[model samples]
Target: MWNRPRFDLKVRLTLRVAAISAACFAAISAYFLVTADRAAHARSDSIAAIVAKSLELQQGKVQWVANPRSDFPNLDPVAAYVMTPGLCLAFRGPGGDMLQRFCSGAPAPANPPPQAFAAFYRSLFDPGREAARPVVVRGTKLGETVVSVDPAVQTAEAWHEAGRLMLALAIALPLLCVLVYAALARALRPTRMIRTGLERIAANDLTTRLPPFDLAELSAIRDVFNHLAQSLDTALAERSELTRKLIALQDEERRHLARELHDEFGQSLAAIRALASSARQTAAQECPSLLSECDGISRTATGMMETLRGALFRLRPPDVEELGLVASLEGLVAGWNGRSRGETRFSIRFDGAFETLPAAVSANLYRIVQEALTNAAKHAGATKVSLELTMRPDEIALAIDDDGRSNEPAAKSGMGLLGMRERVAALRGRLSFEAGPNGGSALRVVIPLEASDRQLLDHAA
Candidate 1:
């Protein structure tokens, strides 16, 4: 719509061109004005000199002719006039009394020109004023002859010449401007295409590209845009993958919880019910077996309570808050080694500031070590295991190694390894699982104690 904002490039170009053209025209006009004024002054001076000389010569002849007794007294001053064989106008003597005057059908002389005729008449012949040459003639003998050459006539011719110059400039300047505009538009053509291409792009149209720009400067920008688009696309893909993984993990957690509740609680309830029914049926007979059954039921209920509490603690350990990480991890290792049946001996080592670690760090590291041991117990098939948990400068490191062949070649779909990866990633730690020196799986993790994160945790604590 006409009311809408427009990005028409031609308008800008036209403004720039008009400014340049106007400057050029101004300079040209100033130069011509100065040159024309100088030329006109020069022409006026030349004519004045010619007229002065003619007057001097004619005066000499008049003096000779007036002296009848002198030689060549009959000679006519007219014969000596150079420009047209006879004077266009003539005057008698130097003092102002014109004894005689002659002209070729021209008007009679006006009284007499002033003494300084050249000075008085200079403005009349000025080029800037009008296109005219006014010539004044005076006699030195009878004091003068004077003539005024009508500049109106001479100026007409000069004006014709000035008109020709103006015409040429008017035509030539516009042609030059057109040529310049064409060249500028051609040079910037690629830029316009690039702008249009950028405007066409949106989130849905990330695949679009700018026209192939060959200019080195422009190509760099094009490459940068392409890289940004590609990076965005890659990041989006990774986020999508992570989202799918998170959903699966949540579902698995729900299933595990459901199973644990059913298997542990359901069996305990059924056993307690059966024990109670037996006690009730024997109570009417007053038998000793009924009392024994009641006692067994009491012990069974106590054991079930203990087992349920243990399972719940495993799901989210309360010991993490009360006993801290060192006590918790030591307890976990002792339990694992006690249960492990194979020749794989588990050893635990620790070094550096265990007690001063932030609670969150302690919790995550404990979980990582627990998971690593569980994995080794279940899958590594090793005979001996070594665990090193240490804190270095600004960092905490955990390593678990076994002495049997590693299962590193397991498929990527294996959730145990995948879960380890996720937990390590969440903690912003590095994780590596590979064959150890003795061909067993060695899992290592390192987490930095970033000062900012430490400060945040300390504040929270």
Candidate 2:
């Protein structure tokens, strides 16, 4: 089932205004119609009384006994004064026969109201109600005068009045809706800015802030949004600082551990291998059978030494600051290629100068590449890996693409990707890992340079 479409604030408010206006117009029209009905009834009664009084005056002046039917005063003059559109006057003799009747003989209206409206008005007010007055001359009943207003005439008048009101309403309602919608749109225009600010914040731009607004409610929102942005920016800065320090400490600890292992285990293993070789040489001729045992010991010591060297290389990578970022990365790729021994191909592409890069950025970039390469080798089973580092005026970008099995699951759950994220976060950068175009996966990192870095680059250029 489809859900009902929801209108925005401006449209909803305009629609509500229109509804209220229509209701009010209906009420006003009803009241006007009722008032008109009462007025019409009062006018009919007054006309009846006037017509009765005129008849009595005519009776007193003329001799109804002398010529009862022949000399009855003419009611034409009275009808001229009392008769009007939708009105009629009548007089009946004592025998209940009509003696005189006068009507306005008004024509039917050109644009008559609908039958429904006429029926409804008649039902409410009974517009055909007659006002009757009995005429008694000298205690002898003469006739009765009756006056009535036409139902159609009264209904038509009420409809015309209501039509005027509806005409005005029809003309004004659309204008009213347009004005209301415009006012609401102007009032809520700041919402667009708020939305943009929120989008920036979602994109990890903690510095984004909403400016002060003219409306009190919008200003309050601005205050809250700016305060929240400020808090988030401060928190992020503190977190980045903390992460940088932690990473520095970790590198220091690794260096110390690597140094200790090299000094203690490395020296011991070298000594054992040298002693075994010496024993093998001496026993080659002295005992002949002990030669195999001596050779086995030497081989085992050599294998242990090789394993320790690999561990040491990972624990304490070459100093990025001393070796330079480009050289360090090149050496790292070379080391990986040497280890892969034709199983995988590793390559690097440098686009711009990195001599002025910050030490922290350089070190983190080196470590990120190292961890990415390790994941590609162990988890992704990549056969070909390529690294691209570009130093632009505004930002530094690093992309690592490999042709291998997709490592998305391992990337999500592995510590290698997490470490890469932390390093990127510390530099206020973005990290994205997704499937490569051809096959396997691609990792991308972008770190915008600070104002000072940009200025330095400009000066260098």
- How high is the lDDT of residue 139 in model 1? 21
Instruction: After the best TM-score superposition of candidate 2, give how far the Cα of residue 133 lies from its true spot, in angstroms.
Output: 5.6
The top-ranked prediction according to TM-score is 2
Runs of candidate 1 with Cα error greater than 4 angstroms are 1-310, 341-344, 408-413, 454-461
* lDDT, candidate 2, 1-461, per-residue tens: 99998879888899999999999989988899889888887887888778777878788877646655655646787887777787878888778787877777668888899889888877887877888888877887678888887777877888899889999999998999999999999999999999999999988898898878999999999999999999999998999999999898989999999999999999999999999999988998789999989999999999999999999988988777888999999999999999999999999999999987888788899999999999998888888999999998789999999987775578545999999999999999999998889988889999989999888877876
Range of the 10 consecutive residues with the lowest summed lDDT in candidate 1: 127-136
Error of 1 at 11 (Å): 55
Backbone clashes in candidate 2 total: 0
Q: Per-model C-alpha lDDT, please?
A: 0.60, 0.88
State which candidate has the highest lDDT: 2
Model 1: per-residue lDDT, tens digit, 1-461? Answer: 37977665765676687777767776775566457556755654454345445555554665668554433211134324422212233343434454444433333333333335323334544422321222233521324333333333234434444455667768876786677778777766778766765665542334557656767888887787778767765665576467446744754685578568657785776678677767766774787666666767767776776666556545655456688777888888776676675455788989865665766567667766766766676666666778998877667788888866575444222666676676665555678887777677778888878787566545554
